[model samples]
Target: MTEVLLEAQSLKKHFPVTAGFILARTVSSIKAVDGVSFIIRQGETLSLVGESGCGKTTTAKMILLLEDPTMGSILFRGKDLQRLTPAEMKEYRASVQAVFQDPWSSLNPRLRVGSIIGEPLVVNRALPSKAIQEQVRELLLQVGLRPDHDDLYPHEFSGGQRQRIAIARALSLKPALIVLDEPVSALDVSIRAQIMNLLKDLQHQYGLGYLLIAHNLATVRYMSHRVAVMYLGKIVETAQTKQLFSHPQHPYTRALISAALRSRPDTQDEEIVLPGEVPSPLDPPPGCSFHPRCSNALPLCSKTTPVPREQERGHWVACHLAETLTVATRATISAEERP
Candidate 1:
């Protein structure tokens, strides 16, 4: 059995809205991540897929210890992160790292590529300056950058090259887990595949666990071992990548899959356009958060929030009508495709 590297239980991050003059009191809160739970196994990549404003980034931030959780806990290697003190938290930072979305914004324009990659090592005081330089050179080579390019600044490299430097910097800490927050979203289409392949190789070489957060299902499909689909601020479905793609249970999952399939001509032509806007987190509707936009929503969907239940082996879904609704949807699609 694969060992669990990171486990987040009922993690919630709610930013309070205070409205007053000098003495401010909390009025309401914006629930960015609400009760999200998942496990990342050692040497496995778990991709979190969701639309924009779905709290995926916030969840990643919490896992990386960048933001404190308002409720619940994050356990790394069976140790509760919230229970740790400032000194321990600083130590924990060495074991966990992050790769942000924009490469241009992530790297310092004034710093050379070598210093940027070696900065973490220097800050952590993990190695001597000579050893750090050698490590930086090796990391650059590992990420497909030439050793001679290390002296150049951020502007000297292309967008993809800058991202490679960002990745190299993340790996410098020798982290056990890395939260990849849309690492390739800013790269060109042609360079994206190369970067993805590099990431896969690095994971294999280092046995690194990843929490890959992205909105692109296709990219997630290629990179992830397990996939979690999120809507609003909650996870609606989670399963092995192959199983999720083959048998999506939640309505939101089905819609996302339908959209992904539509983008590929060889898959299918039908597109499932989810109607209605996503409700505001500040004023979310009662009951199921996705019920307002779900096509097959029933009366119970608006009355009670469905807890995530395992309908199949290693497959969990949070929907009142997952079983019946999924079957009906498959049948409808099959009938439409028949000659």
Candidate 2:
């Protein structure tokens, strides 16, 4: 079995909604990440997929320690992050890194590529200048960038190159886990594949665990070992990539897959369009939050929240009708989705 690098148990993040600027009071709370739980094992990619504002980003933020969770715990190799000593906290910081959506904003415009890449080393390691420069060059080479490009400013590089630079910086600290928040979404279509391939190669080389946050199903399909589909601050479904793509059990999961499949060439699958807008997090609907948009929602769905069940081996679904839906969706899928 692979080593578990990080684990999150029932993580939740709620933002307070205040009213009356003069005498502000807590009006309500926006449950951004109501209760998310998953684990990333060595060299494995676990993707968290959802529509915008579904709390995937907030979940990522909690993992990165950028925002404190309102409830629940984050553990790094069975150690609770909140209880870490100062030295352990520093070590944790060095072990974890992030690659954000936009490379243009992520990179420092004024700094040369070398400085940007080597900054982590300078902060975390007491290495000499020459050693740091050598390390920077090697990282650039590893990412398919020329060694001499390090002296150039960010503006001189194209978007793809900048993203590669951002990746190099993320790799600088030799992190055990990297949270990729839509890392390739902002790149050109052609460049996206190259970056994704590079990331895959790096993961193999370093045995690095990845927590990928992405909206592109194509990218997710190519990169992830397992995927967790989030809906209204909760994970509605989770399974191995091939299993989820081939046999999604929840209504929302099936809908997402059907939509993605419809876009492929010669695909005849109909898109599942949900009704109504996503309800406000501040005032989420009762029971199953997705019930308002679910076409096959039962009366039980509106009155009682469903507990997540292991509907199949390694496949979990949170829905009142997952069992019935499983039988209905057992038809053969496209060859592309086969394990």
lDDT of each: 0.90, 0.92
- Model 1 clashing residue pairs (backbone): none
Tens digit of per-residue lDDT, candidate 1, span 227-331: 999888899999999999988899888888887754645766557898977888998878899988887888998999999999898899999998888688779
Question: What are the root-mean-square deviations of the candidates from the true structure over C-alphas?
Answer: 2.0, 3.0
Instruction: TM-score each candidate.
Output: 0.95, 0.96
Best by lDDT: 2
Kindly report which residue pairs in candidate 2 clash with one another: none
RMSD of 2: 3.0
Q: Residue 184 in candidate 1 has what lDDT?
A: 88
Error of 2 at 103 (Å): 0.8
Q: Write candidate 2's Cα lDDT for 162-221 as tens digits.
A: 999999999999999999999999999999889999999999999999999998888999
The regions of model 2 sitting more than 4 angstroms off are 261-263, 330-339
Error of 1 at 311 (Å): 0.9
After superposing candidate 1, which stretches have Cα over 4 Å from the reference? 85-87, 261-266, 327-339
